[model samples]
Target chain A: MELFTLIDILWMIFFLSLMIGCGVLFYRLGRRSESDFFLAGRGLPWWLPAASVYATHTATDTPMWVTGVIYRYGMRGIWYTFFSAWCAISAFVSTRIFRRSLAYTQAEWQSLRFGGLGSELLRGWMAGWQIFMNMFILGWVGMAMGKLCNYAFGWPLWIGLMGFSCACAVYVLAAGYWGVVVADFQQGIIALAVIIITSVWGIIAAGGPGAIVSKLALMGESWRVNPFAFTGIFGGEFPFAWFITMMVISIIGGFGMGTSIDWYVEAQRIQSAKTVRDASYSIWAGTALVLVRNSLWAVAILGFYVMFPNIPSQAEYELGWFRIGFEYLPVGMVGFFFAAVLAIHLSTISTHLNLGAMYATRDIYHHYINPRASERRLVWVGRISTAILLLGSFVYGLMMEEITKWLIFALWIMAAGVWLPNILQVMWWRFNAWGYLSSWIANLGLSWLVVWVLPAFGLIPDLPDYLQFWALMVLGALIYVPVTFLTPPEKMDRLVKYYVMSRPLGWWGPVRKEAEWRGLLHMKGED
Target chain B: MAWIRRHWTPEEADEWQKEDWIAIILSTFSYIALTIGVALSLLMLAVGFIVLILGIGLSVLLFFVIDPKLKAVSSGYEKKQKEYLEGLERVQRWEE
Candidate 1:
């Protein structure tokens, strides 16, 4: 019989208690109004929101995914890190503009920018799509967490998933924004600590970096050099073009299009800041953290190659960092490491729950179901919606087998249907409400049709995934632009108001007269 | 516009607080130190892998592990700030 030591048991108890205690503390802090519950009363400091954004955006799958790429292609995996860093840089550059635009969601921006039936239709479509995509991504995150937990502790899949979901739901539902902010700050620290420890442990276990690399060199040149030398006719080791494209998409268009609104947690952070400059600084801080954190992961994955040269077929896509931690790290350190993973899962799930509820309650329920609903009723509806979304994600996690595949599919859908039209509207002045609606419908329809027809008839040519993504992006934009120009434009007055107030950078000219007429313009020291 | 008048204020004092200089200095130093420590460890690990492959000694890995202790201080500072923030929020809520 294997006997567990008192130290091991104590370590487990300490972290477990810490996790539960933190959840309860935030829950109490968040029990005020719905705003406090959903957005932490919009009073979080720049650093807290910044840390939360960084931690939540980079999930558990990140390290493993990067390791898998390195395992297959070698130095090329750095491209993914590069592109993701670029996305953070872009966010920093655009934070000021986004902060000035005070709409709660991108859908709200559509209504504010383009009024009438055209705006309503666009808002309704976007709300529905956002809810679907948000739920789908949450499910993927849950599945990855479940797999990690199952491997680490030998727990059942459902048990691990339910544990994460319930914890997330409890904190999010209780305090809304406040709980999420507090928990995110703690979780972010834990995540950094765990990743750093795991990397060090892995390096030590291999006897040293020198020994690990020597072993790899002895094994084969392929292991040491070009990891992606396997690309050929029948799907070689790594499709470089596809990999590069995905990385580019993740960095550039990923956050460029207002699809970032899918991240309600970030929006809450923006809302929390005391001023536009404060909000922008928070984004900058968050982006800086992500850049540093992702780079660490990239290095860690490369280290994995030196440590474990020949990954088995089944464990190819498994998180090498988690596997190494469980196998090599000390018993006490193991508990803290697992707690970090739990932090990643819980933060993402709770953020999604809050965001999904916001979309359903603010965009759909209040707009459609009960336009005159009281704040109390709206908050109740939000809680109910959050509970339901959590349950659905939990179930989806159970049903899904391959988490990476699920995430890729979700990203494709978001890139095509959600991102394409949203980017057009933000960057192009001629993109009208009718054009947004048409682009959205056309993108969804065409993507669905392509998925069905290509696979069914075996006509899906051997092409990289990014090729398909690029095709969709280009085609969606082409259709959206022409259709928008052909259709009657939205009311000029409303456009002028939104453009001036939001100060969005686009083709629109400054509406000085409109600003004065609306009594929005102010002279220095007038007050 | 009505909502704007109610929420927006021209008073600079009410709109903004003095930058939290202590918090900024502490956080920035902690971040820089932690980042450098991580980078050095990564570099050491890489060097160790090369040495082992070339039949060199395993002494470098020890250096990698020892340096991480320096990071503990930074982590302590972060924990302190987190606690301070939580306490401030609680006190504010109670007063309200």
Candidate 2:
């Protein structure tokens, strides 16, 4: 692996210091209140946090993952991110609703949606799972960065990854989400620059884009340029029917995302906005930026195939991005590329650290340990939680060899069970806590049987990701539908308040009618 | 048809949103322009300097031109959820 020169080292130092400077600035500007740190005191302008959202989504593994997909399935591989785009679709409509929900974290939402012991149980359960999910994501991405640094600069993996994790934790602890959002805005700009430049540079290195196309053509690939070209149209890895089915499911998931009471992970931005309109605008704006990001990475991957057609180790093709970064980029640009990587990693990791900490401090501490904790104490607890998450994720990262291997299982299979409940929670009135709880439990147990054990042991035939996703989504709906109908409906008063606030379009006709009768609504009824 | 309007207070109706046309036109064009620009830039990558300069220009436009327009167009959804929170707090107080 190539090493960083003194200039490269200096540039990296400058990059880190700029981030620290942001932390200092935010700390000074912030009022030291919990709301200011966690949600920018609810006064952020639209574009700032919009850019921050886009920046946070641009993770270290994103480019590497895109490159690997393109290499395997051609440029049409971008269709994979369509799953997340559904969230954007829902967020566009739901921004006002999510912001209006006034939930500090998703867990705190249960009490607002349901009543009594059931709401408490649901709140606590959701909190624990959400924290676990966040920690797992942090570890997976941390390991990717660790492996990347080790390869690029030969720094000890633990030192580079764990060391940087500490820096991010400190940055976050300094000013909370203010630092996270500010640093994210700065990082977003640099990261975008590096992505575009490196993409252009890589294509140039590969004898220009036209020549790269010619080389790829000679390699006899048909659908690298056209995104619509699915090999599944014929007998390929992905079938057309399966693609359509998953898309339908994702469209449904979009409704769930839009309707779901909590989005605490991204809720800070939603809450931080000066107006609901701005928060909504932020979602679409961030999506456009994301499109630009994906395009840059796609071009780089397309160029990579032509330049290094026959790297010895085919299995390690995911690291093909390293070849482009080290071999193709000029001296200073290479350093900038590394800085850009750190920028993306920092943006994503910091969000998880801050978000996870907020969930833990608010849900775990405030609910269980100290019901009347002071704001100052809560802020300190938030810091401690962030530090603890960083340490736990670092240890988890050390244990993993490759994050890519687990991703398919994690996103589709492991998380798929929640996909339906997450969707149903917003739309259906009858989905009680027991129904909600059973859906997840059934989903977990079903996924293990359908996607993992049976397929692995050859009891059942192995299926592709789309098939597994479709199966679990259908099975999850079936379980939850029955469970919801069988379980008692949520109390009328609780449901009526939820309907008026969130005002989502779904099976909340009864609640809306009641809200109307009670004179709770200020204007005409909405779906 | 918009949910915001359905629940809008009489006071809120007086608040006319000015031409969101800038955010509308700019974002649409930027999405298309940026996409087409990157495609052409990659094709024109043999002449790397040209694309790099174009890219720098586009990034500048992104921050300066596109961002402010979008920010100006809308900012109305802030209090939609607050009423719910207050209502829920009242319920809790009554239960206590």
Residues A1-527, candidate 1: write the lDDT tens digits: 02224665566566545655676687655655555656666556678778778777767676676667556666445444544333242333234344445455666656776767888787787788777767776777877777776676667777777776786777677666676677778878888888778877776776665565566577765333332343653355456676666545544453344544434446656666644545645664675576556546645555676666667773654477777777677756666666677777777777788788878877788777776666577677878888888888876677677555755665566556556566556655667888877776777676765555676778776345566777777777778778888987766776665654454544554354455466655433556
Worst 10 residues of 1 chain A by lDDT: A85-94
Query: Over the stretch A204-260, how does candidate 2's per-residue lDDT look in tens digits?
Result: 787877887788788886467655576555258756765675566544455564222
Q: Candidate 1: TM-score? A: 0.77
The parts of candidate 2 lying over 4 Å away from their true place are A28-31, A249-251, A258-264, A310-315, A402-410, A456-459, A522-527, B1-96
Query: Which DockQ-derived CAPRI band holds candidate 2?
Result: incorrect
Q: Tell me, by TM-score, which candidate is best.
A: 2
Model 1: residues with Cα > 4 Å off, grouped in runs: A1-6, A26-29, A81-83, A86-93, A212-255, A259-265, A314-317, A402-407, A417-420, A448-460, A510-527, B1-41, B44-96
Quote model 2's TM-score.
0.85
